[model samples]
Target: MNRRFVSKVLCLASVSTLVIGTMTGCGSSESKATSIAQIKDELVASTGAMAAESVFSRGVYVNYAKDAENPDKTYFYVFNGDGTGSIEDGAADTSNYFEYKIGKKDVTFYIGSIDPIEEKFTVKSSEDGYVYGSFEDGLELVFEPVSDVEVDSFNATNYVNEQNGHDFVYHDANGWSVKYDPEVITVNAGGPMTTFVYTAESAGTNMITATYTVDKNAEESIKELGKALGDKAFYTEGIFPGTEDVKGYWVVLNPEEGTSGGYVTAMARDYMEGALIFEMDGHFGEDEENNMLVSDTLAGIVDSLTFETK
Candidate 1:
């Protein structure tokens, strides 16, 4: 019932984080991590004093574990500067506190005689203060600075309590967030540029039929794209309102397949000095309702989006 209109603006996002001293690495099954001493050597050279404070000092960490008391569940915790830490056990809808320290890449709880109720890390420092330690089993883990922004998982179910309200909600790994109705759209599938793929109930809907990408080469790419699109795409600087400076505009796209009964449109948004880019396409039936849905609905969605860029 809805004709198709391609979303034009593709707002990209770019963001970029923490943890631990050590004991023996966690269970033998986990990843075998580089010793803490080695990590320190590599970290200190470029980072200098900032990284001198071991990841063990303070921060939040996320990890998974399975044992007698705790099944293989993921845990998120904040290790305070005072040596005390609080952990969240979502299964129980509860949280607990403990004392912790890293012997190397290993974290021990309570005291010397106590086995590490926590786990260990196979330490790898991608940047200065940024540390990624995979548990021996290779589950992904992150140590986030306490001051970093956070968001509920973008895929959180019941995204909108109202059945007819926006159905899909997303927070990119970096905490940028957005919501949309799933009955009409899909998300990013594979990736190089497009981080999300979306679809609607239009006959023109074809997998890979539409595209979206977050271009790290944003500025050059956008400038190149603007030149290519020529007069068809114009800039409306400061498109994002109430924030720094956000601007975007629409392009009346050409028809796809036969002009039987539909139209396509493309919208692109440039932000974070083009470091973060987002582009979306929409399809609408030949009806005004679908047309309105395509334009108004998407404009509102883009206006409400919130994210941080590095």
Candidate 2:
């Protein structure tokens, strides 16, 4: 797994004071606090994350503050076991030059022209494989051991600024973007499914969606896809280019009378930890042929898609 994937989702700072991981005290009678190397050694040893059989798939999600609605004002950091990551400290416009390395509970920082400095962080809590702690300044930190299988995984890096300071544009960790205009679009995030709806605008009431899956096995995954469609769709084994590792199909339904495009779904992209699904559920305007309007639109999006995983 020599992949360099700094997740697009960033773990943002929030003010929910109800800390979540399991807790421990950093102070010991002999020294009150431990050294950086001692902390990392104890942490990795405690979690057994250094082992090969451990299921600590999801990386760490830490925040200095609480979660905020306005992201530009929020700051956070994302860490992975691959020895790679990033930090967003509310610095806008100016590029913040910094590099970091995380070893067990030990973290080293190399900022600007300054020499690399090492710091020891404590694991105040640990739960479900996640560790929660903070800096010497009591900057609340939580190391959420996540599974890529989980859809709404928290981390500020996961949410991309699709809106280039203009329209409320969006594209998810998954690879699809909506064709509908952002102004008229409404997003519903906290659902069993993440859905984007377009009301009577360009493309005539279009809807885009993304679904996450954790089925590492092929047979079980296909079975789940079948359950989702529930027997009304017509699917053709279609090739989603650049997705050679991800075998998939294009599914569509009979368009309604007077509607230009039909419901289109690009089912199953074998991704990083599991899989993803994309569906365009609306009339995609009139193209040369009938169904091509929807299928072609999906195809175009897929072609322009690129994943940032190493």
Candidate 3:
């Protein structure tokens, strides 16, 4: 199989806004926030401003609901104790650094040192703790606190290979390994299966899951699955690079041209335990133009994967 590689570089644009008259005092949950200026005025007149500082600066916050609506997009924002902060947009996979000013009721974000965007700070209590909610452009955006370790990984320097720009590195106990960028993909490892997810902007989400099987060699296991899937898909058998005599298989789904969602590839190879089976699936909406782009990105990751028999 031929492997295709993909790389990304992002550029940020500045946006500006103006603030009107300031309002003062803490409003109840029943009251709707109008503007950041009013919220700032209230902070100046009350003692709650101090509390707001602690709340905003205590931890990193992420747009929890963005991934559900647009799997390819998620963003994070955090307030530094010194009125400085940053926001990372997952869609573009870029970080925008900024200086921030906190008022009792809202925080103003200054991007590019010129554009001042004001957002109302209404802290809502959830079962998991407190989450900050803001109303912007008719959408009630909610941000929840994430762990410090996860936030640390969001930094570009924290990745596996800084010079090469690879963001994540994983090695299983069985001696298999893989490297990929966390900004464009994420992994969930547990039980007998590991899942990798990639969100393609405007196209859809791609998920690849691998399950380990003990006592079954790669060729035998794949053949069994291929027989069951028969004619429903196309299959190719081969050997992975750097491997000796061990065999592997690749299966691609066959569907109509206008199919909304389907499997892209299913493959497996011999490993320390027995075999590591992988199934790739794509979820595309009405827009499918980016399907090949998403597939190639995911394929690049799989190509980087290496397996060893302990």
Per-residue error (Å), model 2, residue 283? 3.3
> Please, what is the TM-score per model?
0.39, 0.37, 0.45
At residue 302, candidate 3 shows an lDDT of 71
Between prediction 1 and prediction 2, the one with superior lDDT is 2
Report the Cα lDDT for candidate 1.
0.45
**Clash number for each model:** 56, 25, 5
Stretches of candidate 3 exceeding 4 Å from the true structure: 1-165, 200-205, 227-230, 241-245, 283-289, 308-310
Residues 135-242 of candidate 1: C-alpha lDDT, one tens digit per residue: 567765555443342322211133212332534554455335565556655666334343333355443442212223455333454555556655645543335422
lDDT of 2 at 220: 46
The candidate maximizing lDDT is 3
For candidate 3, write residues 1-310 as lDDT tens digits: 1011011001101100223212224454233244544554454333234334445654566665522564322466755657777776544445677777765645566765467565555432222434444545444455666664344445432321443455565555556766666777778988778888884373555877878889687777667776766678777888764365667787777545577565567788877667888777776555556767677767777777765553
lDDT of 3 at 190: 83
Which candidate leads in TM-score? Answer: 3
The per-model lDDT (C-alpha) reads 0.45, 0.46, 0.59
lDDT of 1 at 262: 38
